[model samples]
Target: MTVGLVVVSHSAQLAAGVVELASQMAHDVALVAAGGMDDGSVGTSLDRIMAALDEADSGDGVVVLADLGSAVMTAEAAIEFLDRPAAACLADAPLVEGSVAAAVEAQGGADQAAVLHAAETAWSPAGSASPPGPSGPKAGGGAPAPLTSVFTLVNPLGLHARPAAALASELGALDVEIDVNGVDAQSVMMLMTLGAGQGAELHVSASGPEAQQALDVVRRAVESGFGES
Candidate 1:
């Protein structure tokens, strides 16, 4: 089984909506929503969060994303109360974007830590504050030159959420640094920030031992129109 996700928010409708949107791309992932109080008021509920966490955890572990203020606190309390506290953790990320990224990564079969990284980095442009330089040691112990390529998006919707999530989630698992149109290819939010539409060129660059493989993956996704018309 893959990692699971829990979304905690003040509004029940908001939490359910986020789950609905994320489920589009990660249908197999357990995305539970814990929003509002038992009375359906606009507030956080520890009991609700705890119950949702239990529902989400499927032995692979669970990642929790919460909205501002008490929602976070409630989620933390729920996690702390878990029978296996270490089996779950909270992601310090935007409620919606982080949940989507986390869900995608989890659906891609990423471990809990990697899934957490995907969520926490959802709002960032690159993996780290500074751009990742070339990776992989060369034959002479030198850093390999970054590989670059360009692929035109042929999908009717181009680099939309589903495609972006697929690319970012898959690419994030590789031991390489990739940039698409100047945005980190491993960040779903960053890729969506490109606003690349149909027929737009995706300027891609990568480094590390898996650089070529990463480029090939992008090529396949774009050239195939991401399996769409």
Candidate 2:
């Protein structure tokens, strides 16, 4: 019976992606985010997240999860500034892991400890993520493929809603393992948060029975400027 959860990350897309994934698997953990903004403003993310926290009525006190160290400080300051009634605890894992842990714990009536383990479990075999290669996983795999293809925010809009929506729609149908750099590229806000534009690149790769097909699909979308067509 803990309170709701806040997932803090340097990238909003990553944070959002984790929440989305968590919602499907674990339903108890509510998520808010303190994510990056395009203006290079970090504080605003916290403000936005706290606002979300305000709406939740879970009396058990909230736990705050952070991706990196800075996320910790920011989360602390955010809780302090609001004087929120929920007891905010910071977990040192990426948003995906923290969100998973928080969700499981919140629903199971456990502490944040369980949440941390979920993170560790979430990222494995590939050292938790797709570094320069792909950020997701490999299905029907013999071995992980060589890293190939990347998506940069070279466009002025940095993969905004329209582009992201297009990208999602195009990529969604494919049987591919898509991993977004810095959190989750699968998320629109997270993509928005990348603050990538007019030259930023995001790594995308697929390795599995359908890796080639997935790669082609993503490649076309990226070259098409996030499927602006």
Candidate 3:
């Protein structure tokens, strides 16, 4: 059906990574990323996504996949902002691979609803579930690195600027490759892009030799919601 596809995440790199995998599986896919960028201003990036969607919609309806609920909600709202149909699909997978595949399948004539449903099935609930990382002793001699950790944004203000900045700082202090699953575009800019509110769910991950220590720090920061008071 030549559906135009959109991929939303906390970081552009994460989105790129997932879509890359999907492209290998499928061809001629449209991958538009929205969220924070390294240069600053996720809002600007969101606008870019909106513009691309507008063009893509003119050809065939677009199927959108988001890394998290908040990103999906934001994309939904963004459609409204652009006066476009709120008919985009949402891939709620905790990782980029699942989400991108869902979007690709949707664009390739699969039912958008069904594809997104499948993606959601891959996501972990925000309870006591541990992240998807190695569970062995890590480089820092602590617990094995967790590639993924989820937490509820229980703070009243959600993840505000200070908290997000603090979270960024914490990530900066780690020694692993950090990424947000649901929100793939989660560079420091992606943190600002999602504008996650209270009661939101977040997933973070770190890989490499320092995965364990990085995972611990990320989980702690997530639990703290970046030191929110």
Candidate 4:
């Protein structure tokens, strides 16, 4: 089962717009927009957030990304009102970036924890070191090199949201630890952090049972220009 996402904002247009943008790369993922009050004014509403949480969940769980302080507070209230609070949680992340990242992760079949982690890390400083290795370094030496390859981004926009989401959604489901230029391949935010404009070479590597497949997926997406001309 795949996790879902809810975008909450004071402006109904903003929330819906975010959902629309995120859905471009994650068409199969469930995303709900809860914004504005019943009268369509700029304000948060517990009822709307609760309704979004319900519509967004597909049994696996749901991750809520809210804009501004009141939006977050409203989301929290909605989560608390749920009979099963653990089934949903609020992510403290920037609205657009977090929603897009979370949507991609959810589309990739990540669980609640992984989806939340994706949103939380959306704002991490660019070029930060890779996340901790799955296991500590081996006593004898460093871990074995993963299946690796290099591909230059040919699209003028480089690795923008759509391409990043496409790569992350396709790769995140694989049973592999893949990194593109030292950032997690399954993370849309990390991929965007590269700011890899045209001709920027992406160092793709993977380690796990599906390493080859994961690497191929990224290679193919990059070669295809991620559907861009």
> Which candidate has the highest lDDT of all?
1
lDDT of 3 by residue, 66-98 (tens): 666556667777677755465554444555645
Task: Write the residue-wise lDDT of candidate 1 on 87-161 in tens digits.
Answer: 999999998889988888899898999889888888875646334343323435767678999899888899999
Cα TM-score per model: 0.91, 0.43, 0.43, 0.85
In angstroms, how far off is 124's CA in candidate 4? Answer: 2.2
Candidate 2 residue runs with Cα over 4 Å from true position: 38-44, 84-86, 111-229
Model 4: per-residue Cα lDDT over 1-229, one tens digit each: 5798999999999999999998887888899999899998999999999999999888999999999989989899999999999989999889988888888878877789988988887877532423655444532366566788999988788898778877777886787888888877777888887889889999987887899999889888888888888
lDDT (10s digit) by residue, model 2, range 60-136? 66666677767667677777776653355555555654465346445555555444444433433332433444433
Candidate 1: residue 155 Cα off by (Å): 2.3
Candidate 4 matches the true fold with a TM-score of: 0.85
* Candidate 4 segments whose C-alpha is farther than 4 A from its true place: 125-131, 139-142, 208-210
Instruction: Single out the weakest 10-residue window by summed lDDT for candidate 2.
Output: 121-130
RMSD of each: 2.4, 11.0, 15.1, 2.8
Name the lDDT of candidate 1. 0.88
